[model samples]
Target: MQPPAQVPPVPPPEEEPQELARFREEWKAELQRRRAATAATQASSSPPQPASSSESTLPASPPAKVFVPVSVSQPRAGPSKNVLPETHPALNGTERPTYVSPGLGNALSIYRQAVYAEQRSDLDEALLLYRQAFRLDPHVDRAYHREEMLASILQGQTAAVKKLTVSAATDEEVEQLASNLQNTLALSKPVSTGKAVVTGTLASLISGFPQELAFEPENELESVPIKMLPDELLVLVLKKLDPTSIERFARVNKKLRVLSLDSTIWRNLVSKTYRPPQIPDIEYMIPVIEKHLSDFRRVYIEQPRVRFDGVYIAICHYVRPGLSENSWVNISHLITYHRYLRFLPNGQVLSLLANEEHSPQQVIPLLKPSLRMKGFFLGNWHLEGTTLHLTNLIDASGRFVLQGLEPPSSAPIHSHLHHSSNTTSEDRARYVFVMSLNLRSRPLGRWNRLDMETYESISLETGDATPVALKHDRPFWFSKVRSYGLQV
Candidate 1:
């Protein structure tokens, strides 16, 4: 059958993001309409307006509907006692806060209820009520306060944690206000990214129906869609997403799960997320990617007949030149191994590889608030060669930190130039040069003068340096393969 006609890609308003954007707008308009109706009724009940008839529209904007946090426990009711005041301090205290009433009153009422729920610790009830308010009308706000509250709590908890251990900044109060900041920035981001949205009835998750198309900068779960993304931005988002979320998303929908299986996503994840100088074939890399992805559907890890890692790497070597079994494949790249493989959770298998670089190198390409990052590795390349990578190496908490060149180093170069020199001009120049070699910090980590097997600039600091790093990822495959081992 002929393929679908190619549509001339105009300036898409974020192709996949329309659903989310529409979803938010729909909510905002509804909130406004409800609030206006309530105000009209209130005016009718009061004395006639002055000749000018000014009190036209409420100054407040419509609020976004709150998302209910997903959890294992059933939702419960809020405390019966009222926690928040009926009105803000500036407003008339006697006026009963509009409770999603006929006009602007209803929009304000929902907002009041959301805040009140949090203060009373009626979290579940508040979330439920918040959603109810949003379902009735989603204007007045850009984000659903309850849902934002939930996501914020989780994010703050994770962000404030060090190695999963609680940090000093973590506190009960701080946790409560989680996801709140999303509201402040909602206006800045559109609702959709390639037609994904959170619209539909409350049972959308279970029903699996397509939600409305809208942009949601604060919707969490990678609100930015992959619409017309360049390789650079694509690599960055893939690198930072929480592994679990990507895995879960794959299981949620067939269309979305395939995104997690993108070849580039895995290639970068293994090369940068793990260590460098290790290049496994698409076939050999699939298992690890599938293992980590855990989506209901999985791609194969290797050719139908070749199951061994050695063969897989060897195959990739043929596909791209010198890849080997010892090459590292980050957990995400497992899909490269096969074209069709269904990977599910609870299945277990871990295949280990080797690196011999004793003189550890550090490569960090990106390190900033934004998702973009980069890094490099000069540890070991092809294991068959007589290289120093076979000698200097150590396993620090699963990450292969470079310990420096091995004694029987592969490179035949003398160690004379390797060590730091005296403060003389030549010596000082040498020190500065080596210090500057590091892709990360000049004083801390340094890069090797020679290119690694991939011919990408690999690093080898003076002494053993941890090789794990982050930097702006670039295409490092066009050049000839350089020997990564020391030539002393």
Candidate 2:
């Protein structure tokens, strides 16, 4: 066959549009020229670099970054219209940014991390981090608190600020506010005190009711038995009811509401119930009632008293290092415990400390000195102003004595060494525990939280006192126990 007419190899069809190919080629050429010009400029203007010394003798500096245009092996056919070219110094090579190594460096940040560890019960880690933070900056805690306060402000959490403002108000401002509150209450059509809603002002509401102990029957034929009682007899009957009973009776009608708010009945209630029977009613306590400006209702509501129909509970947690099977791995166990305090009307208080395995429901019924739970102790308690004091602590059964803090100074030193000494263990275990706690309310009206201020073991024999550490202890919060009922 005649030699195939030489056919020129058909060129591969254009992989991309002609416009795109031409633009990409032009870009490549422009980049090459720019690089060449930059190199030339640097060579002409820059001083020659000195020869590096021996690597072992001189510390080597980090390699300087060279600006190089990236080349695409498979060139993009086209650029997306939505995507913008890199312009930020952080994104492109226009500027070299300083980089911090990945680690905790700021003291406030470290302190915050320590607080998180503490909340998680990682005690050891928390302690270490706390020390590190304090060592780095002694004021780290204040800094963290400032940051938190700023954040709260920015988040519109102004409750704390409002409280601060109220506390900081001048005496005149406070008086003015109180006057305003009274005027508002008096002018309002109705007043709600949770138990009852009274329509109109107290004065006007009472005016509509009969002043004398007489009631007009709803029906002409109906007989009202309560209308027969004289005002004096009626007051005596009301005074006999407890404060709670009187409040319930007040919800019956407007006449009963007026009788319930009587200064005399409330005054009698305050006198009878304010001080615990264990504590003598002192002359000074009278001034406390007078401080309410003769408003016995205010005194009755504001006076602090321990609740007997409930228990104060504290939940505590700690972290303990555990024995690990693997040497390289660390093991930790989170141990949770609870503390309970039940007060009896007789001034006897029962205390118990139990583990997480015991729920409150299971523990509440047994939270008496009679049950003799593992951590049970009995103590006498009394309230003074806003402080609750517990003293004369003895274990349940009243026979489990405590170890003496120290021997009496009058005793011979040799007697302590002799095993057969006349000194008995009972006499040596004569130390009494005394705890003072400050009472606070979580909400405005309820006196429900107890924060330990001081705890001491006083030796009756030696008269020496030793303070107990309360670092890890939490505040006790009151929880109502219906089983206890209204004992006090």
1-488 in candidate 2: lDDT tens per residue? 78879879998864654543454465456547645875896599678754432323322322221110100011112212332111222222222222111232377677867766665556678789889998987766544543443232222212212323333333343233223323222222343332223332454565566545335577899898988786557778987775567879888766667767765566555554554432344234445533544455666667777877689997776677878889999987776677788877655666776666556766676565434334555556778878887755543321232223112334321110112212232322234466778888887436788888887765443346787766557899999877777653
C-alpha TM-scores of all predictions: 0.17, 0.44
> How many clashes does each candidate structure show, in the order listed?
116, 0
Tens-place lDDT per residue, model 1, 427-471, is 110000010111111132121111122111111212222232212
Off by over 4 Å in 2: 1-259, 276-282, 326-329, 397-430
For candidate 1, the TM-score is: 0.17
Residue 444, model 2: Cα distance from true site in angstroms: 5.3
- Runs in model 1 deviating more than 4 A are 1-168, 171-178, 183-241, 244-488
Prediction 1 global C-alpha lDDT: 0.27
Model 2 clashes, total count: 0
TM-score of 2: 0.44
